[model samples]
Target: MKLIVQIPCLNEARDIAGVIQAVPRQIEGVDRVEVLVVDDGSSDGTAAVAAEAGADHVVINKKTLGLARTFQKGIATALSLGADIIVNTDGDGQYAGHSIADLVAPIVRGEADIVVGDRKPGDNTDFSASKRTLQRVGSTVVKTLASIDVPDAVSGFRAYSREAAMRTTVFTRFSYTTETLIAAGNSGMVVASVPVDTNAVTRPSRLFNSVRSFVLRQMVTIVRSYIMYRPLRAFMVLGFGMILIGLFPMVRFVYFYFTDGGAGHVQSLVIGGALLVCGYITCLVALLSDVVATNRRLEEEIITILRRMEHDEAARD
Candidate 1:
């Protein structure tokens, strides 16, 4: 089996080489292990450092395409290179490279399609109180929305089997950690998590400017992904909740009409009727969105098939 460890770097020149060199060159069940570094328009000479530090392949973007797109490119490049298994790690070197073998072991053993390296941020002394709380809340939100039990929802260190990598697709430009997990869980892909160690933080987070920004972006990603995968249920709940709320106002208006002359309560009736109409419209939207989501699923399957064919033809050539 061939394993490729792919690092997605963005201006990480100071840490990229160490991350590349830290990757294990051999594993028990793998015949070959190679490092693939994808630079997302780094101003620093991250690409040169990677190549000199023993990266087997280096893919550079002319301009920054953000993390999600860079990760997508790395996965495609690794697949084209005949990687049977793919592991993704941040170029910042915050993740311990020694845990890579443990991360991919589940995939190598055919036990899981994706294996996430759980940093256990809550237990880590390195994490501040606020960071730990945010990690816990974020992970809980992911687990609830995706219906998957992942301890670390935002971990960059992960492993994917060939099939899983081929099937994976990321629509969000912010990050792939949460969206991919939601997709895998909703699509019934096997996902497992293993405890892993982390290195000391050498640099500030480049993902977002502040904690508030991170929370907002992650919330948007989670909600968008949840709606994308489960549109019917999501809209249905909202529609019904609106209807339920409208009912309360309508009932109040009726009681006033029967007991009294219902003078000022005409406004209640208007508000309730408007809400009811909105609820009905939302339900209709739900139906349409579900149809679109179904089409998206079919398109995803077609894309996977085409990718397999293209890769196979390339292998033959």
Candidate 2:
């Protein structure tokens, strides 16, 4: 089994070398280990630094793709290179490279399709109180949505089995951490998390400028992912609520109309009628959305099959 540890770097020249060197040269479960550096339009010569540090492969992106896209690209490149297992870590060396063995242990043992590294609380003492609280709250929300106990949902250090890698897809460009967990759960992949240590802060997070902004983007991503994965349930709840709300006013309007001879309740009748129409329309939209979601699942399955076939062909060559 070959393991490919990939790091997505954007102007990470300073820390890339140490990160690469810290990776284990020998592990019990794997036949070969290689490092892949994905340079995401880094003008700081990150690719050159990685190459000089003895990285096995370096994939360069001409334009700066966000972290999500860079991550996806690295996964694709790793797949093409016949990686049996893929481990992803930050290019800034925030995650302790030595802990990668523990991260991939579940995969090697066939216990999990994906394994996420859970950073212990206070691992990064530099994190603000609000940021820490948000991390906890966001992780709890992800656990609820994904139906899995992922304590560190935002941790970038993760490992994926070949099958899991092929089966996963990321829709949101904001971040892949939460979306991948949710997707894996929805797709019935075995997901697990292991406690791992992290290094000191090497640099500030480029993903978000402020806590409020991060929270806003994460909220959008979570809602979008929930809708994508469980459109029927989401729409059903929304449509049902709207129907109940519409019914309340309509019931009131009817009660008043019959009791008062429909004299001063014309506005109530109009408002109730409009709401009822909207409620029914919302239900109709739910059905359509469910159909589209089903099609999307089918498409993803097809893509997974194609990926496997391509990999098989490459192996034969």
Candidate 3:
């Protein structure tokens, strides 16, 4: 199978050359490797440097599209060029060249569709930086929001089988590592994390900015997907919770009204009316939410269709 290694870059002129040059060779039973460098509008000489370093494909995005779109373009281009599997890593020297073979094993062996490189900050012995204090916190919050259990959710190094790559076309345009895990799980692919080394970059790293933006995108994506994938489920949950809590007061007010004989208690009437109205409105909104959810799912399906066609044609070529 043809393998494409995508290195999404911003302004890393210093090590884009090194990254491309070090695209791991000689793993048993491996065939060809095509290294793709996505140059995300670097004002520096990153594109030139990657080309000079002999990258198989140098995809230069016209503008700075941020991290997610940068990676997506490379993925699309790689699929267009008939890549059977895609492995991605940072343009900085944080990821080791040797780790790629291990990353691809799960995909090649049919054990998983997406394999993530788990980067532990303890591996960063060189730099004074500790594990991102907010990284784990942000991940936990998003997990609660999205109902997923992914650790080390924002590391960039990963490998994807063709099936997984095709399914990711409908994802958030500005997503990164966090979003990828959720997207993979949403797409019904098994997502696994394997250990990898994270080291000081040859160039300064903007991964934290990339990580923060990615977390926001992931939250939005999960919320949107939550509604679309199961509008009925979302509605039932919110509506049911409110109904039960409101029921106690509602029943009490009704008994007081009937047994005590008609609008005899004006306060009870007002309170009951307000509670009922609020609960009904919530259920109504939940039902209407189904309509909105249908439209979103349709939009995602359209993107999926287009990308699927692109992927199939590329494989044909």
Candidate 4:
């Protein structure tokens, strides 16, 4: 078995070397281990530093494509390199390298397709009170959306088996941590989480400018992922909720009209009628979206088959 640890870097020149070197060269069940550094248009010579630090492969992007795109690029490169297992960690040296073996153990033992390293951000002293609270709330939202129990849903340290890597596809431009979990859960891929150690914060997050911004982006990601996987259910609930709320005003208008001999209560009738129209339109949209989602699933199946064929040809070559 060969394990490829991929680090996605963006101007992390100072810490990339240590992160690469920190990875263990020998794993109990893996025959070989290698490091792959993907430079996200870093102007700080991150790619060069990774090469000097003994990274087996370095893939450089021409321009910055955000974390989500960079992560997908790294995964593709790792798969092309014939990696039997892929472990993703940040280039900032935040995740403990020694914990990598523990992180990949579930995949190595065939117990899970993907294993996430739970940093228990709520208890981490390095984070502020607000950040800790955000982590807890965000994780709860992700668990519900993904239908998976991951304590640290935004953790960057994670391991994926070869099959898992081949089947995974990410579309969000923000971050992969949440979207991937939701996708895996929806796809019925086995996911497990293990406690892992974290180093002190080396730098502030570049993903968002403020707590509000982070929360907004994460919520967008969560909602989009949930809608993608469960559009019918999501829209059904929304349509039904709107319809239920519309009924209250309509019923009130009817009661007031009957009691007051039907004078000057037309406003409520108009408002409720508009709401009902909107709710009905939303339900129609849900049906159309369900049809689109079915087409997407069929396309995905075709893509998966093509991917397997490509991988088989690569192996033969």
lDDT tens digits, residue span 1-317, model 3: 88899999988898788777777866544688889999999999899999888988888888988888888888888888888789998888788888888888888888888887866644445543434554566557546644556556666788988877877754555556665665566556787767776655555457445545645655676676556556777777777676666676667778877787645566655676676677677788888887877786677678778888977876787
- 1-317: candidate 4 lDDT, tens digit per residue: 99999999899999999999899999899999999999999999999999999999999999999999999999888887888999999999999999999999999999999999999988899999999998888888878887889898899999999889988888989999999999899889999999999999978988889999988988999899899988988998898888888888899899998899657888878888888888898898889999999998888878878877777677567
Estimate every model's Cα lDDT from 0 to 1.
0.92, 0.89, 0.74, 0.91
Question: Where does model 4 exceed 4 Å of error?
Answer: none
| Ranking according to lDDT, highest score first | 1, 4, 2, 3
Error of 2 at 183 (Å): 0.8
Best candidate (score: lDDT)? 1
State model 4's lDDT. 0.91
Using Cα atoms with residue i matched to residue i, what is each candidate's TM-score against the true structure?
Answer: 0.98, 0.97, 0.80, 0.97
Candidate 1: tens digits of C-alpha lDDT, residues 170-265? 999999999999999998899999999899987779999998999899899999999999999999999988898899889989999999978889
TM-score, cand. 4 vs. native:
0.97
Off by over 4 Å in 2: 122-124
* Tens digits of per-residue lDDT for model 2, 1-317: 99999999899999999999999978789999999999999999999999999899999999998899999999988998999999999999898888989999999999999999988654457677888888899889988998988888888999999999999777788889988988888888889999998887857799899888999999999889999989888887887787787787688878887898777777777887777787788888889999999999999999999999998678567
Model 4 Cα RMSD, 1 decimal: 1.2
TM-score of 3: 0.80
Consecutive 10-residue window with the lowest summed lDDT within model 1: 308-317
C-alpha lDDT of residue 235 in model 1: 95
The better-scoring model by TM-score among 1 and 3 is 1
Which candidate, 1 or 3, has the higher lDDT? 1
Ranking by TM-score: 1, 2, 4, 3
